[model samples]
Target: MTEQTCGVRDVVDLGQDDGDTAEIHDECGVFGVWAPNRDPARMTYFALRALQHRGQESAGIAVGDGKTVLVRKDLGLVTQVFTEADLAAMPGKVAIGHCRYGTAGAKGWEAAQPHLSTIDDTIIALAHNGTLVNFDSLRRELIEMGIPFRSNTDSEVAAKLIGYFTQRGHRLRSGIAHTMRMIKGGYAMVLARENALYAFRDPHGIRPLVLGKLGENEWVVASETCALDIVGATYVRDVEPGEIIRISDDGMRSERGLPPADRHDCIFEHVYFSRPDSIKDGSSFYLMRHNMGRRLARETPVDADLVISVPDSGTPAAEGYAAELGLPYGTGLIKNRYVARTFIQPTQELRQRGVRLKLNPLPDVVRGKRIVMVDDSIVRGTTSKQIVRMLREAGATEVHVRSASPMVKWPCFYGIDTANQDQLIAANMELKEICSYIEADTLGFLSIEGLLSCVPSGGYCTACFTGDYPVEIPKSFYEEKFLPGYTPHNPDPSASDASISISDIAFDLKESENGD
Candidate 1:
């Protein structure tokens, strides 16, 4: 990583952009732990590290042991935000943490969460993963009622809403249920009081939340099964949609936060957001992607000398593609795993040079060959076009690009940061037009039916592809709900309170945003 300033940045990053414009960004990741007599902070840290791919903008952890609560979070990666000493200082039996991308609030320390609020003589810490469609209205209502807020995040709104209800007369679980009824949208939230850890999901299960056990009494909950794996916790089961699970000294109890309803869990979790190793319900994400690729090969017969994936995200599908086609798989594109976020002079040539820094072609492998490039999906078409051009320059005679998922024609409001529908290349063009635009000899996307067939037991959300939303979405909110573009606001060194510096930027879109 390049340092524009002399000092090392507090921001953390792993280098190399995948140069694929058709990428989907994930929303957030949340993890919590309740160990009877052990400090759960370290366990929470390792779990957050495993979930780092879920969010890169910021991270934080909060811990408590019935009487005292301590929080440590900042705007960076888990490795950058906390040291051994830092975790050692806060030794608590219960803890929860968050890794976030600035979706609901401005990009600053104020927006980072594990938001804390003390109301009615009770202190609550919350870390959430998902968007609240009605957050704006709720925030305004709470403001008018004389409830003070600490941050500009929708997470804080939910935390305060729970506190507001609790102060009135409801018990903690009852207040959470009341708050759940008042809110709309997908959420997988982990909340902590002095002695208990609570995990809850939206009524629709639009996001993922799993409950796990470390031993006889310890319990854990996280946005994905991967976090549970990182902590050596055995997967217990998925928290049911509309379920609220409380883990305390007595034991773990499950209660419904919202009434039972049809589940429309985000399909992207199977397609992108989740770690490949994670198992959702009974289906493995790895096996699902493999099925998509195997299906792609059967659906689209291509005359190619070899097949290759874009890298980690596209690898599984590429493996299936090669196996089904009986074609050899090779690493035609070598990704620079360590070249971090860097600033180049703002020149046209330098911009193109940056793409090469992320991915360089293996001339010996693709030279004079017909190549079929398998990628998860394409977004703006800019990165795909560049990659195709790069392949040609390396002496590839033809480039046939295939996407494992259907075209994304709509913007996602349930946490994913897909560019506006207008920004999506597929939203504006036909298959032939998109092929020509990206300079691919041919381009194919897996059919929606084919995508769904991978999972036999399915109630997944494909709203981004079919425009069929499971939950109520305020379409008008899109213009402001997700920011117009990908860039975070530039930091000014002159500002005394600026938490960011030239050295510490976890830069945007260029990196591997493999999941939604």
Candidate 2:
């Protein structure tokens, strides 16, 4: 790793090349509040910073100072964009913030959200975390109705649709109800306006949104409980799937708009996406991952002297696996903390080599030991194969592979960028075949039942594993399904099928001024 100085910060330059593979992100992160008497923007800034791990592409905050919504957003990390001055400039008692990693479409400032729409006299700011499967149909419908879009984001359509309904004399809650009926995908949004803040989750609850209370006067809504902790708020509970929560100075109220035909929280949250410190749907993410590792050990016993995890997401599970098998656990790999999510590489092959820049095997720890490697999930199998090879080169006699989640067979339509079916190794090959292909001595994945059991609540979307979608699956999907569309001059069909690589998805939105 090479170190370079940027402005007073030392940026570590990990010289690994980039790869053509794109990993799907779990969801986006969003936080919003109506603390009219407090500096809600500062609180939101901190909350978004805490949830930054969920997304790295862009960050922004919109403040409604009981009047106009003040907004700022850019394509960069939260810390890189929201300076103290920027946060202070956004002073308001009510604020909403979003951290986004684009799952599909081109990456640009225009796509960086806090998507604001004006209808009649009202302006609504929307930040969404999940994908909309029916976005094409919805976009066409809105276009036919003369609504012009500024970005290629589905959240904009949802915002415009809500704005249109609210302008036509429907209440905010009623507009949400009407909009929910038309959207067919996973969504967790926080909508804020001049006088109110609204939070809602899809019927399937494929994304996560929760409510919290800070003191007696301030109420908070966020994508995860971790964000609540950041703002010194006590976690209230998860915003139930299909539930609409309305918050204002008059106190909080909730109205159930629709009941889930099936409760399917995204299973990947526990396995790889969410912060270990977070509590989702009453389940401890850290504990759930630990249990998954323990179960993986029991189900797929292997002879190994040490258990090692891929850093960050895979650490807790590796510990659990080690404890279950009475094997020693050690920090066998280290990740360079400063690597940007999207690094510019000279070529696609060079990019594939970039994973090593982020992660490197600790040769001293793994040398001469039979290692059991635990990771969250295996998508295209390229990263896993690369990691395994790195371990072998570091002198491991054997590398036994295990995934904390079940094999993902189907692509996700609800915001997650697991877009191409054929790219998934588990989708096409048997366990034994995959093991050989990846050059692992043995490979084991958490069972779908085991995954469901790990969750605090029984309801969650394991569609990627079970191939059972909670909502009606769309016959066609957006081009930004898993990978960004190629430019006219540079078309790479292979790059277009890569999975969405961000960790989580959640967004905060505010109703347009006209209430429509």
Give the winner by lDDT: 1
lDDT of 2 by residue, 1-516 (tens): 333332211223232231222356855789998798889989998999889888988988888877778789998888888888897788776889999987754568888878887757666678788887777777786787788987878888788878876665347687777678667778899887766788898987889898999977679999889999988899988898999988888888989967654677787777877899998656679998999888777766677899999888888889998998899999888999878665355487766575787889999999999998998888778778788888999999888788887788777777776777767777776665677667776678777776676678567777777666666654466243322321112123243212221111001123333344
lDDT of 1 by residue, 1-516 (tens): 321211111111122122236456777999999995777999999999899879887899999878867788888778888999999998887999999876676778888879997756778899999888668877887787788886777899999878876654337887687678767778999999888899999877888899999997899999999999989999999899989898898899999877856778888887777899988767779999999888888777577899988877788888888899899999999988765322235488757564676788898999999999998887778778888888999999888888888888777778888736667877776566677777877677888888888864758778888767666655455554333443222123242212332112112211223332
RMSD of 2: 10.5
* Prediction 1 TM-score vs. true: 0.87
Q: What number of backbone clashes does candidate 1 have, counting pairs of residues 3 or more apart or in separate chains?
A: 4
Clashes of each: 4, 36
* Deviation in Å, model 2, residue 303 alpha carbon: 0.8
Model 2 segments more than 4 A misplaced: 1-22, 104-106, 343-352, 478-516
